[model samples]
Target: MKYYVGIDIGGMTIKGIVLDPEGKALCEDVAVTGSERGGDAMCDVIAELVNNMLSKCGVKKKDIAIGVGCPGVIDSKNGVLVFSGNLNLRDYPLAARLHERLDVPVSITNDANAAALGEAKFGAGKNYKNRILVTLGTGVGGGIIIDGKLFEGYKSAGAEIGHMVIERHGDVCTCGRRGCFEAYCSATALVRRTRRQMEDNPRSAMWTKYTSETANGKTAFDFYHDDIDAKEVVDWYIKYLACGLANLANIFRPEIIMLGGGVSEQGDNLTVPVQTYVDKELFGGTSYAPVKIVKASLGSKAGAYGAAALVMKD
Candidate 1:
């Protein structure tokens, strides 16, 4: 049977998956990227994991092609990673190198785009012609899939929604830009806001969840179910997030807006509140450009699944 391999590279973990031609999971493996150990070492770890997974599945190297879901500016056509601030990857021919080592065809894509394709082909966006998959993590990551295919525009850095400028003079982003959505709406943003709040009002109940001495180290989202301040921060955060979502919904008018990342796991608390805000602020009367808000069904594995799909077509 024909199979494809998918790899999702993150700051901490590197997950690899194998799927049949129909995209069914045959095997999955994970490795630590060893960020401190550097990129070349991390690639060796990935290769080991891939070889091990194929062996466990009783699949040959020639039976599968590889697709990598990496974090960075990927030139998908040329198989080069132009830049990756988090991973310290730059101008590397990742696909060609991996293909040479593994003795199989290999392709790579941005994690966000891979997740978008995963959703389009097998997850939430499967039934839609146009959809957006937004992931709120340390920073916001986005995947824009139009029609049934992943949109890789102008050298593959096309749909970077988090970097979209919402405010010209807002919060400064990691990319040195001011007012990018990721700077304002990411988990890092929530953490920053929590710290400022703690400094201003250190005796609040919110600080109780962080255990006085440790309050300075944790993020607002670290608040447990009983943490009131955490809820407040999230409420405010969701409101800010809605501003972006509303703007996108009004402009793109997609069938549905799919959210991923740790924040989306909050269930109705996040999605319901954000959707309510959108209902109130959006120009459409809720019927004309009605947008449904849903969480990504594939969760953390979406990127790997999507990358795997790239080779299954072989």
Candidate 2:
């Protein structure tokens, strides 16, 4: 029997999991990213986290390899992290260093790409050969899978779904662009839009439940049934989300588009509406080959599960 280790590195926490050959998690644990300590310190912390997970499961290091899902531009072929604003890393040879210290073959990928692979192999996308994962969190990020393989573009810098310009010259994006998909469809965008709507409709019931400070991605969603403003906000979000998704669907025509991250917790409320729009606008109509819009089953662990898959034998 063989085992593998997967680690998902975020700004605040580093999540690690040990998995058997069949993908069952034998043990899992987390550690503070300690990102303030710089890239070297962060890698050390990740190595320690892996060791802790291995110790907890009583697994021998010889039976395992490490797979890391990191946020940022990664040179997967060279096993180097080109840049990660949140992790404060640049041009770091993450895989090589980890292997040097832990003596385990290490693989690395962009977090979104890893999550997509995880879902495609073991989660909602397991049944499909081609799939795309659209995560609506603080920002929009996604990964593409084609013929059961992850597509990381040239130099592993592609698949940046969020930065796509859906509403050209519409709204300013954090990437310093106008009308990027992420600027209008992310959870952060949802909250910002909801807050503006709430302010515009001072007498609406939404004001009773949330203020600008209390408004979040779920605020309008929770009040959608009774508040016109709330419903409008959700509608606006769905419109942009569907536009971005439609672009991907037309280009890749994936069998399924899996939604993940915080906003996806809305489940059918989010998927149903977005699917309706996607169905309407997808190229060549839905009759020939319709894309199934579904929710990501792995949730927060998708990245970890995907990381582990990097070193697993299909």
Candidate 3:
């Protein structure tokens, strides 16, 4: 059977997948990116992962098309990573560099864009023509898909809904911007908010779970079904995130919006409240829009699968 390979490149982890031409995953492998070493080290690690996956799958190199899903602003047309904050890379010719080390053709895309492609083609977006994707992790990252294809925009950072300003002088974000959606809705944002509330009262169940002794520690997500403080934080988080969703709904009217990452781990607690906010902010007659909100079906693998899809496109 013909095969394809997809690699999800992140700050600290690299996930590799071997897929049948039909898109079924036949083999999966992973390795640490050890990103502190930066560009040259990342290249070697990726090459080794590809070779390892190929060997284990018993697939010849020439038979497969490969895709690499990478983080940051990417110039997909030229196969360059304009910037990757986590990896501290700028204007790196990743595809060209990898091609020189491997014989097969390699295609590349931004990580968020890949998730949009993966979801639009195979996940909750399968039935939608236009969709918005948000991943609520350390920071909120987003993508826009129109008619089942990722939209990278002319500047390469298009559909970066997380950076959309929600407050003119609100919380500071990692990007040093005030009031970006990411400063309010990301997993880390949730934690920080919850921690601040918890500080006022350490006896709450959420704080008790981790305490000055436990291993796992209290998290922003605990409020979902548990502690009152955590619940308060979650309520506000849903509100902040909903503002972004509402903006998308009123502006683009996508068929659906899919949420991923750790904040999504709250499941219905996260989605149900966000829906409530959307109900309030949506333009009059929004019920007719049919823009449903959903959790991502692909999880972390979406990145790798999306990368693989780059090579799979006819």
Candidate 4:
């Protein structure tokens, strides 16, 4: 029997998993990322994680391949992490270093793209040939899968969907762009909007439970049924979110768009309205190509699961 190793490199923790070709996980473990020590240090920690998983599963290194999901601009073709601000890496030969340590084939891609592939292969998108994952966290990140393969355009840098402008000359994004999808659609954006609404309406029910500094993505949703201000904030958030999803639907038009990350925890409360808006605004209507909006099932393990899928053979 053959096995595969998947590593998800995060700022605080590096998660690793061992899986069979059928996508059944055999073992899982995590290690400190120690990214502040640099890329080489990170590689060592990953190698140790791989070894730990292999040992737990009683699988030989020769019987397995390795794949990594990392946060950064990756040259997937070259197996190099081109840049990662959070990881503090630049032009790092990630796959090569891992290959040297483990003596096996290794592959890598942007973490968001990896999560998309994971969902496509085994999570919400498993039944669809084409799908897109929109993760609403600190920022809006996404991955595209076309015909069951990742579409990492132009040296694996093109799928930075968060940077796509949804509102012209609107709020400024961390990427230095105004009106980007991330500026309006992320959990952070939701929290910001919620806080702004609470500040603007001091008598709002939202302030009964949260202060401007304590407001979060769920604050408005919590008060939506009772408070006018909260309802307006949620409605405003959904409008921008729908705009972004509609833009993606018009361009890629995938069979389904999976929502991931913190805000997605709202589940049907979020998907139902967003679905209605997207269907209404989708190009040429939804009869010919209706897009389904659903929440990603994998949650935090998506990146690692998708990384394992990366090394699985057909």
Model 4, 78-154: lDDT tens digits are 99999999898999999999998889999999999989988888899999998999999999998999888899998
Q: Estimate each model's TM-score.
A: 0.89, 0.97, 0.90, 0.99
State candidate 2's TM-score. Answer: 0.97
Residues 1-314, candidate 1, lDDT per residue (tens digit)? 38889999887899999997777899998898885676677778888989999999988988888889888899999888898887887898888778767888888899889888787778988788788888888889878766666777887868778888777899899889999989878867776777676667666667655643364323565563556666677777887889888877877777788998877776676788889988888785697768878888999999899888766662
Residue lDDT tens for model 2, 34-128: 98888778888988888888888899999998889999999998899999998888899999988877998999999999899888888999989
**Candidate 2, position 293, lDDT:** 96
Error of 2 at 84 (Å): 0.9
Candidate achieving the largest TM-score: 4
Residue 85, model 1, lDDT: 80
Q: Report the alpha-carbon TM-score of model 3 versus the true structure.
A: 0.90
State how far residue 305 of model 3 sits from its true place (Å): 0.6
RMSD of 2: 1.1
Identify the runs in model 1 with alpha carbons over 4 angstroms from their true place.
Answer: 34-40, 211-232
Worst 10 residues of 3 by lDDT: 211-220
